[model samples]
Target chain A: MNAIEFHSLSKFYGKHRGIEGIDFSVSKGEVFGFIGPNGAGKSTAIRTLLGLLHPSSGSASILGHDVVKEGVQARLKVGYLPSEVDFYPEMTSRELLEYHAGLYGIEKGEKRIEELAQYFELALDRPIDDLSYGNKKKCAIIQAVLHEPEVLILDEPTGGLDPFMQNRFFELLESLNKKGVTVFFSSHILSEIQRMCDRAAVIREGKITAIEDISSLLSKQMKKVRLVLKKETKLSLPDGFQNHHSTGSKHNFDYVGPTEVLIRWLAEQDLVDVVLTEPDLESIFMNYYQR
Target chain B: MSMNRTLYFKELKRNRKNTLIWTSIVVAFTFLILSIYPSFSQMGDQMTELMSSLPEEYARALGMDEGTWSSIIGFYSTYYGIYITLLMGIFTASTGATIVGKEERDGTAEFLLTRPMTRSTIVTTKFLALGTLLAVVYSTQTFFAVLGMNVFGDDVLWRHFVTMHVHGFVLVSFFTAAAVLFSSFLSPKLNYMGPVVGMIFGSFFLDAIAKATEQVSWLGYISPYHYLQLQAESGSLEVNWGSCIVLMILSLIMLKAGHARYLKRDIVG
Candidate 1:
């Protein structure tokens, strides 16, 4: 059985759609990514599986247990890191972790907690209210992994982490995956998802637009090309290039063809300066939506 | 340890300050009000004359029964006891209203509900924790009220003292359960002061209106205060099993229905 499965799972907040007909599955030991922009229902899908939001129709399950019917059992081996990690501010990190450890029925989690804290450079002794956003995020990371759950579900988990901590967190997740832990990572950041996931699902307007292996998805990566013409010249675009918009002497468009072909074309054109950058997830996502 | 026990302790720790503050307010109020009993009792005939001069309906509405003013337990029950019940009702109602909504308001609902626990279990544990906190507050207030009367008023009836606390608990439980019921449906902003204050004071005024206007005397039956007042007039601490059972059953119904709604709620935060 899959580690996580959603069968036509949908949630509606009154008349407003939270997530509609969200269907996906993550196999055991796979780091599956969920990519969507804000209000695109990434958090809604994650929260439904976690039993924080009840589905308006259909169902979901984790570890072969129904999320709604046997929610406690479904969550028995799961760890969740919410997008907004707000904790009891008055309590020290140690106190809050101890409280969570008790909830997960973890006896003697201090050693594991301390190890994660050290990895993330978390100040575990300070009160959580006094911690910076980054420090609080580190604390969130530590608490989530201390129990070493069989499945990890993170919604925008790396938002407040520094580059170093983000790398360390990825390494930790990789190790955990190696130990057969399944992960469901949700974020609007496409590159992060590409960097971490084996497979990814792109959602928009509460609907799944695409689900593909990371390698194939990366091949479809769109590069935004901006060229400054040395002289006033009318340039004709190629068949594979799309979203070509020219302003004055500068031209910007998304290129999906081979880099060698683009480089050859650029060499032939009278170009003063040229810069090729990766288009953000929004533009890429918009292309998918239009398709 | 189980999730419910862990959550219960966490909730208790969170409510520790609130419990202390509310309990102190009720206890202090009880002490302050009962201290006036000494002066009133000493006036004797002058007090009776003073009472007769006041408008009868106005005085009764203020909980001053002319005949009961001379007796220590009677005066304490009519004056301080009624207000103690009101304060306890507010305390319990606020506690019930905020306990669940606050989690959602502060974005901690995701943290707590995502644990390996069912929504039912979470609600049950929180309800138990709130019940435990109110129990502590009520018991402390009772202890202080009894002690205050002994110190200040003198000649206090132990039965009335004990009965008043019992009655206060039942009345507060009804309001608290109602608040929990409301909290499940309303957002945090609406749940806090509005429903609780409205229900407690609304029912209170209804009871007062029923007493003042003969035609609406049936209105008293709709308010928990009327039942409390009825039992308070009976003059014995031997549990008024009728009202106690009714209030307990109604509270249980509210709690069960509330839990069902809470289980199905899609937490916005």
Candidate 2:
């Protein structure tokens, strides 16, 4: 079953356009990444899905419930961590988490609160205003996942984390996904999505340009192969090789066809080394936006 | 239901200090006004004696004929009523303005909105919090004002005190509703200014129309302070129960409209 579905969703503020004709779906238990630059309507789409904003046109549904008409019901199974997490300054992290747990009607909420606090290695006694940005984000993440929700919507979840903490967050998300939680996250960091998501949608200028399986998208548009010959040599390339650029020591070419032709061509030359690197999600995203 | 109760209590806990401070201020001012009633009564007699020596136009211009020294109700109606009403209106409106908009100012709306509760629930909970605070403040002030009046004067009846307080509550309700309505539409940084300016201008306009022409007497009907007349000679100074009901209904309707707008409008980041 699809966990979320958006059909031609559009939003506008006065005459300023937010997003238009956005459509996508995330399957249950799949990690879907939404890749976009800042102000590309990534947050707008997420807010619409969470029923925090009304779409000017089209519809959005989560777990078979319309976001507009059945907002409370749709939100019951969803956990969200906003990009900029804010909390009551006077409440301690533990108090805030308990407050959120109560909202969800979680039984024995203290147990879940303690477990999440320990998992994140966060000090629960510190007031929210006294905590660092990363700690506040930890509180947000803990609150989002503590209820054991069926779907997680995270916006730039690792924006402020150090590399070690980012890895820890990835592991935490992976553990939750293993338990059948569908994760839909937006991020500017392409490598995170490349490594974690099963599928990703690239959005540019308020529209989704592509939604494809991570492997398929990378393999189709991002294969870059470099051939280094033993001696200075001019080489003829295969049919699918286009946009070929060369330096003195190596030739860089992008291909959209089978790898065999490149291999056959390399066999004809005295190649000292040949290196192939698939374009990461970042490169693919930049390429589309630049165009 | 339990969640709503929890949220309500939390809001109260967060705002209790400010509510207590403002309530104390309003009550102290009410008591102070009551304490000065004797001085004003003495002045009224001295003014009457002095007016006996003056021309009729000067005495008439000062309203010496209509003014009386013995009646505490008259003292309130002519002197303290409008002053206290304006004070209460500003306080109530400012409190309401800060209720919802402060969440946005503190950057806490994002956290609150991401919870499992619906948008309407959040708005309604905040509205209840503001309502409770306004009621507590106005009630406390009314209690102290009546206590001071009864202890200082003989002719002040308990029924008059009750009527005055009922009118105060209705006026406060109108201001609270107006402030909340503005808070829902304006940014938090600018929200407080709207209510303050609205109350000041609204009172001024009502007062001007009341003094200008007999034909414009109906304009006072639009002002919340209009129904607070406590010195009608015919003993017809009962509470304007119809206007009170309308104000309460208007407050609820504004709250509903705020909830709907907040639920549908996008956050400004």
Candidate 3:
């Protein structure tokens, strides 16, 4: 059975559309990515499946159990890491994790909690109110994985983390995926999605626009190219380049074609230096929106 | 309809500080009110003359009479009807209104509702914690009042005290349940203290005004405080078992409705 499925699931906040006809599935042990810009219903879809929001129509299920009907059963094997962390400010991280362990009926979660805390370099004794946003997020991660859940639903899990922590977190996710845990990863960061997902579903304005293998998605990668030339000279541009503008001897433009072709074109030019940068996710999303 | 013991206890612990603060206030007020009864009891003919001088309607409206100052229980009953029950109702009702919604308001609902427990269990557990808090505050105040009466007053009518307290307890419980029901339809970010105080004070004054003026006596039926008497009348008091049972049933219905509403609520973060 698929690890997670949303069969025409929809949610509305009264008349405001949260998500419309969201239909998708994550196969068991698959690292499936849900990608969208902010307010594009990525969180809504995740929240609905986690039973935080009641669907306006249709249904969702986790591990073959209906999210709304058999919510407890569905949730038993699922661990969720929310986008925003808001723990009870009065309790220390240790107290909060113990409380979380208590809720999941994990009698021996102390060892797991300590292990994750050490891995993340998180302080266990400080009150949540006293912790930084990044520390709170670390606490959130530890709680999410402490139960050894079979299905991991992570919504923007890397927010408020340093590069080192983010790296560790991704590594941990990779290890969990290797352990046969199905992961439904949701984020607006395209790089994170590209790095972590095997396949990804792109959502725009509460609708699933595209679902593609990471290989094909990478082939459509958009790059920002900047060139500083040897003297000012006009050169004919290729078909896939747009927004080309020049100031003095430097030229900048966005490219959305094969890197080799762009390189072959760049090699033919009289150049001082050339820079190719991955455009921001917003740009990538705009490219998808155009598609 | 399952109650989680772990959540139940955690909820209680969460509200422990507020409970301790409010409990201390009520207990201290109980002792203070009872401690001053002696000074009034010694007024004798002066106090009677004062009661006679006051407007009769005003006296009845405030649940006061000449005999109210004659005994410890009767004296305690007047303040209990006005300030004490109002205080208890406000604390419990405000707590009931926020216990579940606070999670939603603070963005913790995403973490909580995602847990391996049904929404019913959350509602059931939180409300049970609310009830336990009400009992703790109520019983603590009652214990201190009893101790104060023994220390400060003579010929204390213990039976009347029990009847008054039972009535007050029922009134507070019903208000707490009603607040839970009311909160389900409103935003969690709302300042419920205003409405909670309004409800309790509104019920008290409505009953008071109805008793004061016969023309508006029908209005008393609309308030929960009317059915439950908190003051002794005709030098005697008894637990109104019929009213108690009806209010208890209504409280249960409100709770069930609130639970159903909460179960279907979109716990927005």
Task: Name the DockQ score for candidate 1.
Answer: 0.74
Assess each model's interface with DockQ, reporting 2 decimals per model.
Answer: 0.74, 0.58, 0.76
Q: Of the candidates numbered 1 and 3, which has the greater lDDT value?
A: 3
Top candidate (lDDT): 3
Model 2 Cα lDDT, one tens digit per residue, A1-291? 589999999988888888889998999999999988899999999988887677899999888888888877888899899998889989999888888877787768888788778877899999999999999999988988888889999999997777887888999999999999999989988889998999999888889988889888777675778888777777677687777888776888877567676677778888889888877777777877776
Instruction: Provide the DockQ value for model 3.
Output: 0.76
**Candidate 1 regions with alpha-carbon error over 4 angstroms:** A220-239, A243-286, B1-3, B152-155, B230-240
RMSD values, in order shown: 3.7, 3.4, 3.3
**In model 1 chain B, which range of ten residues has the least summed lDDT?**
B229-238
Q: Estimate candidate 3's alpha-carbon lDDT, on a 0 to 1 scale.
A: 0.90
lDDT, residue B151, model 3: 98
Models ranked on DockQ: 3, 1, 2
Looking at model 3, how many pairs of residues clash?
0
Residues B62-150 of candidate 3: C-alpha lDDT, one tens digit per residue: 87788777888888998899999998999999999999889989888887898999898988999889989999999999889889988
Q: Clashing residue pairs, candidate 1?
A: none
Residue pairs in collision within model 2: none
Candidate 2 is graded, for docking, as medium
Mind giving the per-residue lDDT tens digits that candidate 1 earns over A159-253? 89989989999999999999999999998777788788999888889999998887765566678899999886778887678878888888988
Candidate 1, B138-176: lDDT as tens digits: 888878877877787766777766676677788889999
Q: For model 3 chain A, where is the 10-residue window of minimal lDDT?
A: A278-287
